[model samples]
Target: MKNVSLGLALFTLVACSPVSQKNKGKKYFADLLKDVDKIQLKFFNHGDTLAESITDQTEIDIYKELITGKRDPKQKIKCDSTGEILFLSKKDVILHAWFSSRATGSKYDKACVTYSVEPESYGSALTVRSGQDIDDYYYKLRSTANRMAQH
Candidate 1:
């Protein structure tokens, strides 16, 4: 009877959150922002890590737009960031650059963690991963992402 009661309790908790269930086959960054005592929006690799912080609202707005914006399918995308763009976070520091990658030879174009701003690839989005669902962060990003199409 004790086992039955425990199982029932578990079921109730799980059932209450269909969103949790929907995320079963999916992945989320469980710990990217865990110990981050400081929340900063800074440039990843613009010039200097500490030098470029996102203090301007317009800059943030532009980032917000970029995160929410869809890449042009015909763009044959390559993320060079033009020195002032493509910024995303790695370890509390948002870098405008991504780690090295090789072409997978798949239909998908070459992608980096910071490069994928589309909604469908929610898993690696710089905004989503760094935010990592902390303090309902995904809500805003997801809202923007919803307007976009999958790769």
Candidate 2:
């Protein structure tokens, strides 16, 4: 009876443990930005400083949409993180995103994010690739950083 009870308890624990599901037909990460007021883009290679601080509501919305874009079906094995963007609500960071590319001039992109604010699927590391759109976004960021640094 003691062994049976232990086995049952172990089975229950295993059954109740939450599993991290792959981001297939799902958003890349949870929406932890409802209270986010600013989105700051920081580049790793470009002096690792704050490149842009998007406080405007319109721009914030646009960036949020771009950040929370769909994930690729297959998991690609490349992580050359170019930079990270911080989603902030007031002075606090809500979500921190690390963006990467498979290679320079490649269309593959990856986002490894950690949320300061928790959601249902919180604490799970996810990688999302959106091909050309992501590549374009990265170039836009790099160019913006370069353009701003010149002034």
TM-score, each model? 0.27, 0.50
* Model 2 misplacement above 4 A: 1-14, 20-31, 46-50, 66-77, 101-151
Model 1 steric clash pairs: 44-94, 44-95, 44-96, 86-96, 87-96, 88-95, 89-94
Model 2, residue 135: distance off in Å is 8.4
Per model, state how many residue pairs clash. Answer: 7, 0
lDDT tens readout by residue for model 2, 17-136: 544333321243335567889987665654554355778887676556544434333644354456566889987987776655543232445444323223332222232333333445
Model 1, runs deviating above 4 Å: 1-50, 80-114, 117-151
lDDT score for residue 48 of model 2: 50
Tell me the lDDT of candidate 2. Answer: 0.54
- Which lDDT values do the candidates have, in the order given? 0.35, 0.54
TM-score of 2: 0.50
Query: Each candidate's root-mean-square deviation in Å?
Result: 14.8, 6.7
